[model samples]
Target: MSPVFSASAEIDDGHLHVLITGEVDMATADTMFQAVLREPAERVTLDLRAVTFFDSAAIHAVVRLAQQFPGALTVLPSRQVHRVLDISGLGDQAWLRPA
Candidate 1:
């Protein structure tokens, strides 16, 4: 079995930066969802550079996160991670920017 996903967040210069690791799937997507949205922030940056795996559920969670902050949510997705976003139509959303 895979290790449970883990995430941490910090506010830097008015932007919330969340670092995530492990697999983010149906079982763990909500954790990232709650961790990020529970706090009110003008902007959010999800650091998915360390995430080794992610599924459609994870993509949905990120879409929701994007809705919460609209144009203020930036995503730092690994090269492998970008494909999912592109397919999900999230990559086309003006609200989501890849870094």
Candidate 2:
């Protein structure tokens, strides 16, 4: 079966709440990346609680977005997602939250 991935964003409390679901592999990472790029908010919070699986591509996409936005991005990753961020050395970035 083909991997499924999707992301949606909403602005709340002066921040963009991005909800991501499904597996985040190379094929689907771009959808998440585009969602982040399209958000027009001062801050971004990514909710990854529903993400079942993720790969380096997803990690890199988040890192790239954080770099592009500087102090404007925040990641509210689930426990499992946190592990991937930790392994990618991106947990130390200022934008990563709930660490």
Candidate 3:
């Protein structure tokens, strides 16, 4: 079966806010990544509190976006996302914040 997923993005005051729900594996990583990167913004907030799965691809996408945005990206991670990122040693990044 297909992985469940949905993503929405909005820009306000030069900040891009993206909300994502569902699985974030290879199949949906690009979708989430593109949604957050589609527009130009001075800052970005990625909300993943409803995400159920976060795989390696999702981690890669997050890393890439973090690199692209530098100190301008913030991530609100769900339990699943926090677990994966913690295990992957990326949870210590300055951009991760409690939901």
The CA lDDT of each predicted structure is 0.81, 0.82, 0.94
Tens digits of per-residue lDDT for model 1, 24-44: 899889999988876677888
Clashing pairs in 3: none
Off by over 4 Å in 1: 1-4, 95-99
TM match of model 1 to true structure: 0.84
- Report the C-alpha lDDT of model 2 over 1-99, residue by residue, as the tens digit: 743677888887778888998898898888898887786778888888888888999998988888877988878787778888888787777877773
Model 3, residue 92: displacement in angstroms? 0.6
Index of the highest-lDDT prediction: 3
The most accurate candidate by TM-score is: 3
**Alpha carbon lDDT at 20, candidate 2:** 94
Better of 1 and 2 by TM-score: 2
Query: Which sequence of candidate numbers ranks them by TM-score, best first?
Result: 3, 2, 1
